[model samples]
Target: MYCDVTKEQDIGSLVQSTIRLHGRLGIMFCNAGVLSQSMKTILEFDLSSYEKFFAVNVGEVAASIEYAGQAMVKANSRGSIICKASIAAGLASDRNTDYVMSKSLVVALMRCASSQLAPHVIHVKIISPGPVATSALCATLGMGADDIESMFLRMFRLKNDGVLKVKHVADAAVFLATNSANSPMSNKLEGKVAIVTGGASGIGEATARHFAVHGIRMMVIADIQDELGQKVMESIGSHKCSYKHCDVADEEQVKNLVHSTVQNHGRLDIMFSNAGIVSNTTQTILELDFAEFDRIFAVNARGMGACVKHAARAMVELKIRGSIVCTASTSASSGSERFTDYCVSKHALVGLVNRQANSLGCMGLGLKGVTLDTKHIADAVLFLASQDSDLITGHDLVVDAGFLVR
Candidate 1:
């Protein structure tokens, strides 16, 4: 049953009614939200008008979870509650400040709940879908049928050899509700340190903030761009977060950065090898300039290799088993026709993940590969970094909307 999540009394009444009807709450789907249409940019936004959006989109969802989750805990039942989130949580598209801010807060709030509630037996999850053809989205965006279809197609990265529908999320929710143990926790990886390279902008920045929001005390943001790196550090605040400047392609700099992180952060927990350069050329492989290929490889391939090398060494020396996640791309699997240099570099990254996973497996450390969705990659990194995947090592977490199989 769905109820307006914003009203505390309404949420409380809904919980009371659900328990009364079903004897106990089997699951909770915290999915009430509002989208901004007319007020697209922050400059155009009225604070009072936008406050309603936050209340409905984020606040209500959190309140529902708090009330519903406490009920589930009291019942001592195994349950998984899923929340509706969006890729907007990561990407800052033009003219969507209010929507993006609300979605981003939803992610942060859900992560906080996940950590606090995990010990009790209630599982909290967020499903971040890309542009879906929902009536609400269409109405808000004021797009016609053709515009709607085109928007969906542009974001659908996966080959359209198959049909995708909203029912996919519905089915996933059903599974989370019925499953006995969706994410059973072991005490591993608790209180571990993490390093997020390039943790200053784009996907890296989002992932770093996500991890920090999840109670990772020590996070080292290694980036060559000092200004942006420092900005991220400031934005996340300096509790256990610190910034370091390092050209990942240089062996000495990589080594020094890892050393300082270990010295200061105490122990390594998760290594997010996410920094990479995109080639300026958008040409076919045969026509692409050789210099473009070298430039991309130096950063995407050699840079990643250097990161893995030093981070793994620190983990091994400290005798701390940790998970290392490298950012690969969907372009790695197929030719991006226009982005040949970048494509080949991404392909090489997959090879790096495989080889490093094999190499680190012998040392009791874990290596996981991740492909990017320009949005879900941050969430995927959080999933890998969390305590849920203790046994998942040397595996590729493809976040490309199912492109590998397609």
Candidate 2:
């Protein structure tokens, strides 16, 4: 029977009708949702638009869960409750705040329900897909297949295998519903939470994707580029990844990002302060502008310092014994012409890492100052973030394709 999940009465009736027809309900999939066609930034967001999106994206999911839980309990059946969420749920968008917020709510709701319903043999699972080539997404974004593919390639750092399909989601749902054994894939980073700053593109984005493949419990990709960040989050799949807008140069934003990660995920296991920029207008020391020096230091040195400070604070408070990895260039050790400011900033980062390693020693916080296509950097980060590198800290692991050796 058809029913409007947004209406309580309809949900109730639908549940009753399903029970009557099937004698019992074993599986419930709450998949109804909506998104705005026109994009609006946070400043231009319409509250009414948020309300409309939330009614379907969040409200319907909640109602479906309520009614489904009742039906399952009444029948004494062990079943799975699966909800559809989007990559948008985890990523910040320049224009789709409403969609992002609503989708995030769905994940939060399912997490709460999962714990509460576990004892009853009712499994609550959330399926947060990447950019699936669905009619709805196509219509909402006003993009065709070619356009979508091109965008994904340009913005997503991951290898372009193909766009996610509906069948992939369906298969995932089936696996979650039936699987009882602990799969190796699911236990890679079983209970770890990490934050990847500058994760919108390049090495940061690559690290986020790598973590997802290894089964990180959750990852927050923090970057200043909202659009690119969203694409990175979507590319990695929202099931275990999210994006936050953060300018590491802004101490307050860095603090909030770390605190919010801990607040949402209980504990933070890793912090990849990988956001750094090269000077667009390189100049010799004789011609170097103090302003240019300041800008570079703000991000490369001070920004990293802020991230380390906040991440360390969170780790200490939670007694997490987490790892913090900062991105450092070969320039940290060697100087280059026309890159005086950049080299100085990197050297400063090395110093900061050294100091943090000593200061956070009491807290058992490991710090590594380190990259390459980003995949190489990601690999180093994975090791530093894992138990394998617990013995290593306060060192720079440079990846420059033998640039220094040569």
Candidate 3:
């Protein structure tokens, strides 16, 4: 069936036909845009053209979301809804005034729809990507793929190795569409295979069962405790969950654990690296046993790193953009008076998220000034929340300190 996004009836019919064919709506990706627009500045923007552009770009997105969301709700489907936005929505651009404004409105519409649909247990999200060398973009610029890629790299000030691809965006969409990190109340883990380190007991055991209950295809419970791990796996049923003794502190064991998971399941989607250790000796720094500190670091820091490292390796090698979550503690961020070794190790574990430096065209927390300005944003928010931006509807007030100007 030929579907026109601008026609509400067309979108609605598409949704109805989809449900009729699939028996249930599991995920909906709303994508409609006006790509062949004049790259005009705000001052030169034509109101008539702007209205027509929005009808396809923003209005069509709204229509698709409404129809898809209604279909999911009626079918009692707790699925995911995703929309596409661009980095232009967040930054001020020199041209394409109508395109930028439409994206901004699309973002707001997705947020409002998400809020309204939360009660129905449907998850709504957006994927905002930088310049991608899609065919449309290549045609728009009248440049080939290589030329456009080089232009984007220079325009964005990205590193030599950093190249954005449409596949990266699609991978992100696939992850969000099958979000496994949803609330325990939802069965978003459907058809996922997971490896939970330290899954014998405590938080690991609980999460293992929860994943199994939420429709995980396979749950590999890896832990040092053989008997406990076996019990947890059996209780969850051998069909869904299985046990494997893995001392995360040992690199060989971690490597084999991840390898076997992929070998058995064909793919590994979620890696819950929750394995760690606490202090066994005097927790204070003055009396902290050096040997015990080493033990703690072996498990909490080194072991977790090994797990994440191997899992990441497998995922990247297999072209799987999977999720790897390390269960770090509050001590990872804040200093502690006791369990000093434990705190340090947990901080090392958190290096995956917060580091002094980073790679892949992304930098970690670099300057101390950003930390100091945590409280300063409140003043800017107050101004916007007040009468300051009453006239500036649908505008993103960049708080950057003159960086974009340069």
58 Cα displacement, candidate 3 (Å): 1.1
- Two-way TM-score contest, 1 vs 2, winner: 1
Ranking by lDDT: 2, 1, 3
Measured on C-alpha atoms, candidate 3 has an lDDT of 0.69
lDDT of 2 at 200: 93
Q: Which of 2 and 3 is the better model by lDDT?
A: 2
Q: Sort the candidates on TM-score, descending order.
A: 1, 2, 3
lDDT tens digits, residues 1-406, model 1?
Answer: 5566677888999998989988998678877777886546766777887888888988888888888888988889766778988878988777778888989988888777877777776777776755666778778778765577676556543221112346655644554455312334333334768888888799899888777766677789989889999989988988868999988878888888888887886778788999998877678967979887888888898888888888888888888667888888888876676988888888888887766675576575767788876475765777666644444455566655334333
Q: Over the stretch 187-210, how does candidate 3's per-residue lDDT look in tens digits?
A: 556676789888898767866776
lDDT, candidate 1, residue 215? 68
lDDT of each: 0.75, 0.80, 0.69
Candidate 1 vs 2: which has more lDDT: 2
Which residue pairs clash in candidate 3? none
Per-residue lDDT of 2 in model 1: 58
Off by over 4 Å in 1: 1-190, 403-406
lDDT for 339 in candidate 1 is: 85
Which residue pairs does candidate 2 place in steric collision?
328-370
